[model samples]
Target: MIVDDEQPAIELLEKYVSMLPNLEVVATSYSAIEASEILKKESVDLLFLDIQMPLLTGLDFLKNSKNLPKVILTTAYREYAIEGYDLDIVDYLLKPISFERFFKAVQRYYQNSDRKNIISESVPERNHIYVNVNKKNHKVNFDSILYIESLKDYIRIHTSTKSLVVRMNIGSILQELPGSQFVRVHRSYIVSKNKITAYTSTDIEIGTIEIPIGQTYKEIVEDLCRS
Candidate 1:
């Protein structure tokens, strides 16, 4: 669950949470009062909470609520670090949070909690993946995928019919794809193994399109040749 007054902050955290296969967002609230209401029905193992909210601050809510689950405080202010730690929060994240910092905070939670098995659990095989685009979930079949390109925080999924610019990172999207069908040929590219029409030491060709291969990924030359 993520609780923040700002919509962008909630969306940013949602994007981060999506990167972790084990983490699932159950709810998001714009205020502490709204979150309190949600807690009555939903059982959340972890809470990504913002310290400064409109009516009720995160610290005030924590003091008032009973049987509160583990918490990780998210705030831009530095003064509240001591107070937040006094509340026994799993971690404190200063905003604009980077993915590396966010990952470390999540690791802290796993180390402190007994639910470590959740991190190691394997995802079941699937032929398609549902990507959220324009506020809707679009079903993208693996067979239709030609290649994927990274655009910083976003990725473009090029398919047989069309392309979609999704708000996802390259590493996260790669985990969602099957290893046998897809390979990361470069830092910004993931190509379908079956779609490769031609290749060389420096690049791979899919149809008329040419995708560069990174120096570190040169081993893929031999791997693809064997495959």
Candidate 2:
């Protein structure tokens, strides 16, 4: 699915997507509302959405949808990139998108989708897990965490305002967080999309601190941006 008010942009995307092997441009709409209607009646695996559209923007469409597919935000402005990532979009493409950038975004989605499937298969059925922090048992909400940082043998949990330190491995803590919201961006850092302030290829800024992005976790971070 592709939603954009500009015919040229839609045509360009349609042409580019057609060249891909396992992808298809299912639908195109000038308005978000029209796109919503189509989505309600059909199954769409991916959405190429324009952020600035009449009647409703791409963000508005995402908020209103009951079932969301992988979304790639297409916009003229770069300012919305952070917000788009916060919303867990698949990728952010600047206006006048080139074929190379578009292909990169699609490839990202495929990789992420494959990884998610593997994770989901291995996940146990549970809502929450216990974490021992500072010799006290702290019941952490899976969705409330912003990020986690490893400091020697202790791991710091950054919530909306509060921070808790627990003596545990970062990998152990990551297992407790919901896979959909939390992602490891560095060897020492795991971030929650709901609490991320901003991010780049090098770092993810959460609240007042900037967490480094490890080379091993770059693909995961990019996947997080597209989520």
Among the numbered candidates, top TM-score falls to: 2
User: Residues 1-227, candidate 2, lDDT per residue (tens digit)?
Assistant: 99999999999999987877567877889999898889888889999999998879888777777778899999997656545665767777887787766776675676567444221212133455567865778777776677888876678887765888887756446534555567778767888877788888898887787989988668877877776
Model 1: worst 10 consecutive residues (lDDT sum) = 116-125
State the weakest 10-residue window (summed lDDT) of model 2: 116-125
Q: Could you give the C-alpha RMSD of every candidate to the true structure, in order shown? A: 13.7, 15.5
Candidate 1 clashes: the total is: 0
**Residue-by-residue lDDT tens digits, candidate 1, 90-154:** 77787898776677677668856787546553344578999999999999999999999989878
**Error at 82, model 1, angstroms:** 0.3
- 109: Cα error in model 2, Å: 0.3
Clashing pairs in 2: 88-227, 89-226, 90-226
- lDDT for position 224 in model 2: 70
* Candidate 2 Cα lDDT to native: 0.76
